[model samples]
Target: MKPQSMLFTIYGEYVRHYGGEIWVGSLTRLMGEFGLSEQAVRAAISRMLKQGWLVSRKVGNRGYYAMSPRGQKRLDEAAARIYRQDSQVWNGTWCMVSYNIPEERRQLRDQLRKELSWMGFGMLSTSTWISPNDLADRVREITVTYEITDYVEIFNCQHLGWSHPGDLVEKCWNIDEMNQAYQEFIEIYRPQYEDILQKIQNGQEIPDNYCFVEKTKLVHEYRKFLFIDPDFPKELLPDVWLAADADQLFQDYYTLLNPCANRFFDSVYEPCPLVEANEVNS
Candidate 1:
């Protein structure tokens, strides 16, 4: 895994639970389990800091890092989607965003598209995106963040269309491809989950560090769905969906590994002291 991506997984799965911050040394040590060099970890952290995803604080000579408000909001949203048990009930309304950003701000336009896609909006056209989810607040935030409010328009309306809603879904997204990916996930992890369950049933003692590694890897792999899975509402999904099955397996396997994993993590985790907000550096 790339150092930065792995760091995000670690932060989302581990560090966020323990006070939402970590010492740089502790970060490097935890990353060491994945064979990442300290230099690589530091460089990734630096890049994240520059990207406004991290804020730093200094206590004496030691430095600590935590997610900024933007980062925290993003991770919170991701966690909600990741652990959601049921598909949202669609109100038969689609949230559509249409934009005509200037060519001079091409970078902003690209970033907006990426953000929209990440939020489960599918591109209906080169300049228009749609999602079944109600995302007015999220869209507003993105437009403000990119300073493109004037170029963007948001609407919540029923699809009184010439084409069926399902056809629009197909046109905007590759549901078959996403379903196939979920099937692959189930095939790979089901056996591992069964093996571990059997081991537990036989009263076999698993190592704490081993559980930690397994849990982290499991979460890392499962969290990829956050990017690829738009998590469409149940009414919009196919009759047979493997994403739900995959989600259940992930939850079970994660629960099975959590205690030992947390124990191992606590052994290596070093907590940082809280400082006043103004005293911290961004």
Candidate 2:
């Protein structure tokens, strides 16, 4: 895994739980478990700081890092989606976003498109994006974040046209591709899950560090779906969706590994001190 991406996994899976902060030394040591050099970890941290995903503080001679508010918001959203169960019932309303950004602001337009995609919006046309979820508030946040409120408009409406909703869905996303990805995930991890379960049943002692590594890699792999899966509601999904199966497998594997993984993490984690507001500023 790339150092920066690994750091994000560590922060999201481990550091956020223990006061949402970690000493730079502790972070470097944890990164070493994944064969990342201290120099690489430091460089990744610097990049995250520059991108406003991380904030740094100093207490005496030691430096610590924590998620910035923006980062916290993003991670919180991701965690919710990552651990979410099967799709909820859809109300048959589609949230549509239409933008008319000027040619002069092509960069902002491109960024807006990326943001929309990341939020599970699929491009229906050149300037129109749609989702089955109610994302008006999220769209508002994106518009405000990108300073493109004047160029963007959001609507919650039903599709009453010639094409079926399923057809629209097919046009918007590659369901076959996503299903194959889930199948591959199942193929890769189901064996690992079965092996670990057999070992536990056989009274074999799995090392805490081993569990930690397994759990981290498991979550890291599962988290990839956030990029590719739009997580459409049950009403809009294909008849033979594999994402539900993948979700169940992930939950089972994660539950099996969580205790030992947390034990190993707690052994090495060094939480930041709770300083007074004024003291922190100083």
Each candidate: RMSD: 1.8, 1.5
List, residue by residue over 1-282, the lDDT tens digit for candidate 1.
888888888888888998889999988988888889999999999999999999998775688889889988888888888888676567899999999999999999999998998898988999999999899889998899888999999999889878788788989998888899899999999999999999999999999988988898998888888877788887788777799899999999999999999999999998976566556453
- Candidate number of the best lDDT: 2
What lDDT is reached at residue 84 by model 1?
Answer: 82
Give the per-residue lDDT of model 2 (tens digit) for 1-282. Answer: 998888889989999888898999999988888888999999999999999999998886789999999999888988989988656679899999999999999999999888888888888999999989898998899799889999999999999997889889999988898999999999999999999999999999999989998999999988888887878987888788899899999999999999999999998888877776555521
For model 2 the TM-score comes to 0.96
lDDT for each candidate structure = 0.89, 0.90
- Evaluated against the true structure, the overall lDDT of model 1 is 0.89
What's the lDDT for residue 201 in model 1?
99
Candidate 1's error at 36, in angstroms?
A: 0.8
Q: Clash totals for all models, in order? A: 0, 0
* Weakest lDDT window of 10 consecutive positions for candidate 1: 273-282
Per-prediction TM-score to the true structure, in the order listed: 0.95, 0.96
Per-residue lDDT, model 2, residue 126, is 97
